[model samples]
Target: MTSQSVTPASAPASAEPKVNWTILLLGFAGMVIGQFMAILDIQIVASSLPQIQAGVGASADEISWIQTAYLIPEVVMIPLSGYLSRLWGTQKVFLLSCSGFILMSVAVGLSGSVEQMIFFRAVQGFVGGAMIPTVFAVAFTAFPPAQRVTASVIMGLIVTLAPTIGPTLGGHLTEQMSWRWLFFINVPPGMLVLFLVSRYANFDKGDPSLSKGFDWFGLVLMATFLMSLQFVLEEGAKNDWFADDEILLLSVVTLVTGPLFIWRTLTYYNPIVELRAFANRNFFVGVVMTFTVGLALFGGTFLLPLFLGRVRGYSAAEVGTTMVVSGLAMFATGPFAGRLVRLVDPRVLMFGGFMMCAWGMWDAHAVTDQWGFWEFAGVQALRGVGVMIAMIASQQVTMSTLPPHMVKNASGLVNLFRNVGGAVGLALLNTSLTTNTALHMSELTQNIQNTNAGMQGMLAAMQERFADSVDPAGAAMKAINGMLLKQATTLAFGDAFAMLAIGCAFAAFVTLLAKPVKQQPGAPPVASDAH
Candidate 1:
C-alpha cells in the first residue's frame, strides 16, 4: 500500500500535508520546548544532589532515589504514551502532561522531606516522559518532507543537548541560587510552552472508541515489567547486582514478568505498546543505531563528569564547566548536520558519525588526573558532532519509511530502545569502573614490593616529605597506597573509554547493513528495497 493509504482519515490529510506553516511551526516549537524541559530535568540534579540531600535531610543512599524514582516511572510511561495519545488525542495528552508536569515541578521544589521529594519526582517523571515521544511523533508526522531535516536537527539537538548541559546548568543554578531552583526553573518556560501549544497544536483527534477493549491487564503487566526492569538496571550496580536481597527479588520479578508481558502484548486484542513495529527491517536497524547512540551519548556524558570529579578533584561547577564543551560543539554542529542529512546518504552520515564518536572515545583512553577543559575539548567536540549527526540519521532511518499511521507507535518504540540502551550502558560502565579499579589495585599492590628500587625510591621520597611527623614511615606507606589507588582508578577509566570506543567502531560497521536512503527533489527520502 502507498503511504497515504494507511493514514487515518481523521488524521492530517497527508504525511506532508499542505497546512498553515505559521501555526504548526509555533505549536511544534512549543512542544519542542516542553520536551527540552522534561529531558533537562532528568540530569539537572546530577551535579546538585548533595545540596538537595542536605535540604531534604536525606542520607547519602536516600539521595540517589531522587533520580532513580524519576527514571523508573519515566521509562514505564514512554512506550505507553503512543496508546495514550491515540486514545486521548495528541493535543489533550500534551496539554495534560504539560500541566501535570508543571504542578509536580512545583511540588518537588516545595518538598520538605526526602519522601515528599521522591513522590513528587516520580509523578513529574511520568507526566514529563509523555512529552518526549510525543515530540518525536509530531516532528516526523506534522512537518512536510522538506522541513523534516530541520525538524530532525532541532529534535536531535534538544535530545542530546539537554542532558549534556543539564549538570552544568544545575551546578550554576545551585551555586548562584539554591538547589530548589532546579525544579522551579522549569516553570517560566513551561508556562510559555503550555500557552503556545494549547492555542496552536491542532494535529490529530483522538478516537475514544479505541479504549473499548483496552487491555487493562496488559497495561498492568507492561508497567510491572518495565518498572521492575528499570529498578534492576538503575540500582543493580550500586547494590552489587543480584547479590543484594532486594535486587535479587526484583530481578526475579523482571525475569518472570518480562516474557509474560511480551506474550500478552502480542496476544492481546489491543496492546499497550506496539511490538509489531520491530517487524519492519529498516525500523529495526534504525532502532539498533539509536540504541548505540544512547550508549555513546549517555555513556560519554556519564564518564567525563565522573573522571573529572573523582580523579581531578573538581567541584560540581568545575565539572560542569569542563563538560560544556560538548554541548557547544553539538549546538554548533546541529544546523550543519541538518543540512548535510538531505545531501548525503543517511547511512553514510551514520557511519561517519559513529566513527567520529569512536575516535573521540579512543582519544579519551589517554585520560589522566591532570586532564581538564582544554584536554577534553577536542574529544568532547568530536562526540558532540558525532552524536548529533548519528542521531539525525538514525531518526530518519527509523521513521522515514514507516506509514504515517505507524509513526506514533513506532516513535514510542524508538525512544524506548534508546532509553533502555542508556540504562544498560550506564550499568555496564559502572560495573566496569568498579571491577576494573579493584582488579588494577590488586595487581598494582602485588607488583609494588620492598625489594623494588622504584617502590623504595617513592617510599623514601614520601618519608622525606613527611620528615617532621612522628610516624613518617606510616605516613609514607599511606601516601604510597593513595597514589596507587589513584593510578588504578585512572587506568580503569581508560579501560572504560576503550571499551566505548570499540562499541562505537562496531556500530559504524553496522551502519552499512541499513538500506541507503535516497531523497528525491520534492519528496521524502525513500528506503531502497534492494536489500
Candidate 2:
C-alpha cells in the first residue's frame, strides 16, 4: 500500500481532512516500540559486555569489536535509509528492518564464536539503523501540524530515555540470568510492534523506477567515510589516537573519503542523501543545536554510569535507578514543554534547556564517594528538563521550516547529525577523563612525600585504623593511593561536566540566529494527507 504524503503549506485551505486519531496512535505506538528497541540494543550490550566476552571467549581487543561492529554499520546505513525507503515504502522497510533486527538478535545470542557475533551484529546495525530515521520521518506525517510538537515531545523522551534505562535492565538480566537474555528480551516487544505495524501501517509505495538512477559512487563514498570515521572515533581513545598504526590508517581513510562523500552528495543528481537540507537557515542552526543535544545526552549518560559504577561503588542496577529520575522528570514535564513549544518562541526553550543542563552538570561537580540517590536524582531531574526542552524544540524548529517533500530525506540527516555528535562527544569525554585522571593523580601524589610529617602521621593513623591487616604499612599506603585516584577521577569528571556546560552555552547562543517559521494562524488541524 502506498503511504499518504503530508500536505505542503502551499496546499489550498479546504484540501485538508479532519484529524484521524486512531491511525496516528497506532503509528505512534509502532514507531516508539521500534525506535526504543533500536536505541536500547546498544546500551544493553554495552552494560553486559564483560559477561558477553566470557560467554564468547573474546579478549579485550575482540570485545571492543562487538560495539564497533554494530556502530560502524549503524552510522553508515542511517543516511542511506531515506533512499531505501523511497525505493520501496516506509512501512515495508520498517517491517523488514524489525524482522531483521529480531532475527539478528537471536543469532547474536546463539553465536558460539566472536566472528559470528560480529557478523550478526553488523547486519543488525544496518537493519536497525534505518528504523530510527524512518520512525522519525513518520512522526511528522502521522500527527497534524497542530499536535506535531506534542508528538515530538513524546518521541524525544523515548529517544533520550531508552539508553538510560537499557543499562539497568541489562544489569538486572545479566546478573540474574544468562547474558544471552539481553537479546532474547526483545522478542515479546518486537512481536507486539510487528503486529501493530502489519495491522495499522499503510504508506504510499515508492517509485521503484527511481532505483535505476541511484548514485552508486556516492553510496560507496558515504559508506566508506562513515565506517572509517566510526572506527576512528570508537578506537581512538583506546589506541591513544594517531599513535597507533590502525587508527592512523583509518583516520587517513576517513579524511579522504569524507570530503569525497560530501562532494558527491552536492554534485550528484538525486544523491543518496539530500544534502540540500543544510541550505535551509533553520535546519542549519537546528543541526548544530541537535549536535549539542546528542553530546550532552550521550556524554552525560556515559559519565553518570561510569562514576557510579566505578568510583561510587554502585552496581549496574543502582546506576540505572539513579538515572531513571531524569526520565521521570522528562515525562512529568513533557506535555508542558510541548505546550510551550506551541506558544513561546522555541528559541526561548532552546536557551532554557541548555541552561538547565549546564546547571545540572555544574551541580554534579561536587560528587564524591559519599554521594548517593538524593544527590544525583535532583541533578538528573534538572538535566531531564533540559533534554525535553532542547530536543523537542530543536526537532520542531528544524523540520518545520522545511517543505513537506524534504522531510523524508531530512529525517535521516537529523538522526545522522545526532549520532555523529554522540560518537564524537563520547570519544572526547573518554580521552579527557583518562588524561585528566593521570594529571590529577600526579599532582596529588606530590603531596604524599615520606619526608613530610603530616603525610607520615596520616599514614600512621590509617594503619592504626586497619590494624587487622597483616601488612599495615602496605595496606595504609594502598588505601591512601586508592583514595587519591578516586579523588582524581572525580575531578576529571567535574572537568568533563564543565566542558559540556560550555558547549551547551554555545548551542543556546546559536539558537538566537535561527529565524522563526511562520505558520498560518487559525489553520484547521487535520490528519496527515495521502499522496
Candidate 3:
C-alpha cells in the first residue's frame, strides 16, 4: 500500500482532514524537542554528579538510583508506545506524554532530598520513554510513504544531534546555573510543543488496536528481566559479581522472566510490540545493528567522561566540552548524509560508518597517560561523524524496507533492541575491563626485569609517595601496585573501545545485506517536508 499523504489547502475547514503543513512542522519540532529532554538526561546527570551528590548528600549508589529510576520508567514504557498510541490518538498520547515529562522533571528539580528526587525521576522516565517512541510513530506516519526515507534522515539527524548536544547544553547550564536548571530547561520548549500538538496532529487517526487492557503478565516478565539486568551492570563490581546474592537473584529473574515475556508477546492477539515485525528481513537485521549501535552509544556515553575524570583528571565541564566535537561533526555530516542516502544505498553508508566508528574507537584505544587533550578530542570527532552516517542511513533503510502499515511496528522493535543493547553493552564492557585489568597487571609486573639503581630509586620514590596509604615499607611495594592499577584501567578502556570497534564492524557487515531501495520518483535520500 502507498504511504498516507496529507494536503491542507484542498480540504474543507470542517473536515480538518489533515493538519496544515505549517502546524504539522510545529508538531514535529515539538516531538524532536521532547525527545531531546529524555536522551540528554542519560549523561547530563553524570556531569552534575558532584554537585548533585553534595546537594542531597547522596552516595554513588543513591545517585545511581536517581538515574536508574528515570531509566526504568522509560524502558518499560517505550515498547508499549506503538500499542498505546494506537489506543489513544497520537496527539493525545504525545501531548499527554510531553506534559507528564515536563511535570515530572519539574518535580525532580524541586525535590528536597535524594528519596524525593529518585521517586520523581522514575516518574519522569515513564513519560520520557513514551515521549521518544511516539515521536518516531508520529514522524513516520505523518509524512507520505514516498517521503519516509527523507523523513527518516531528518529524524536520524535530530536523534543523533539531540543527545550529542545534551552534554554541551548540560555543561553550560550546570556550570552557569544550578543543576535544577538542567531539568528546568525543558519547560518553555515543551509548552510550545503542547500548543502545536493541539493545532496539527490528527490524534483522531490513532491506531485502533489498543482497546485491550494492560498486559500485566508481559509487563511483569519484561520489567523483571530488564530492570534486573540493569542492576547487575551498574552494581556488579560493588556486589562482587555472581557470588553476590543480589546478582544471583537477578539471574534467576532474567532466566524466568525473559523467555516468558517473549512467549506472551508472540502469543497475544495484540502484543504490545507486535512481535511479528521481526519477520521482515530488513527490520530483523536493523534490530541487530540497533543492538550493537546501542551498546556503543551507551558504553561510550558512560566511559569517556569517567575515563577523563578518573584517569586524566579533567573536570565535568572540560569533559563535556571535549565531547561536543563528536556531536558537531555529526551535525555537519547529517545534511550530506541525507543527500547521500538517496544517491548511495544505505548499505554503503551503514558499512562505511561502521568501519569508521571502529577505526575511531581503535584511535581512542591508543590514548596514553601523556597524551594531550587534543588527541582524545580528535578521535571523538571522527567517531561523531561516523555515528551520523551509520545511524541516519540505518534508520531510513530499516523503515523504508517495511510496508507502510508496519512502520510503527518496525520503530517499536528497533527501540526495544537498542535499549537492550545499551544495557548489555555497558555490562559487557565493564566485565571485559575488569578482566583486562588483571591480565595487564600480570604482564606489567613481568616486564620489570631491570634491577638497576635508577629504576630502583624511581620505584623507591614511588614507594615513598604511597607510604601513607599502605605501610612504611609497604609503600614501595604498593607504589608499583598503584601504577599497575592505573595501567590496568587504561588497558581495559582500550580493550573496550577495540571490542566496540570490532562489534560495530560486524554490525556494518550485517547491514550490507540490506537491498538497495529503488528510489521513488522525486524522492531525495533525506527529505523532511516538515510543514
lDDT of each: 0.89, 0.83, 0.74
lDDT score, candidate 3, position 507: 82
**If ranked by lDDT, best first, what sequence of candidates would result?**
1, 2, 3
TM-score, one value per model: 0.94, 0.93, 0.89
> Compared with the true structure, what per-residue lDDT tens digits does model 1 show for residues 1-531?
144466677776534455687899899999999999998998899888878988999998899999889989999889989999889888899899999999999999999999999999999999889999999999877776667778889999999999999989998899999999999999999999999889999788898988899988888888888899888988998899978999899999999889999999899887888788888778989999999998999899889988987889887888899889999999999988887787789999999999999999999999887889999999999999999999999998888878888888888888888888888888899999999999999999998853688778988999999999999999999998998999999999999999999999999998888887757335544331111
Model 2 lDDT tens row, 1-531: 012245555765755465566876896688689989998887786667778899999998998888788888999778888888888888888889999999999998899999999999999998989888887778776566666766787788888888767777787888889889998888889888888887777654777987887899898999989989988888899889999999999999999999999999888877899889889999999999888898888888878888887788777667767777887888887778877776678888998998898888888877766777898887889888897899998997899888877888999988888888888888999899999999989999986753688888888999998899899889999999999999999888888877877777778889998888665343333322111
Q: Cα deviation of 475 in candidate 1 (Å)?
A: 2.5
Clashing pairs in 1: none
TM-score: model 2 vs. ground truth: 0.93
Off by over 4 Å in 3: 1-19, 207-209, 212-214, 446-450, 460-481, 521-531
As a whole number from 0 to 100, the lDDT of residue 389 in candidate 1 is 95
Ranking by TM-score: 1, 2, 3
| Candidate 1 regions with alpha-carbon error over 4 angstroms | 1-17, 467-470, 524-531
Which candidate model has the greater TM-score, 1 or 3? 1
Q: Which pairs clash (backbone N, Cα, C closer than 3 Å) in model 2?
A: 2-203, 2-204, 2-205, 3-203, 3-204, 4-530
Relative to the unseen true structure, what is the C-alpha lDDT of residue 214 in candidate 2, on a scale of 0 to 100? Answer: 86
Which parts of model 2 are misplaced by more than 4 Å? 1-13, 462-472, 520-531
**Residue 504 lDDT in model 3?**
81
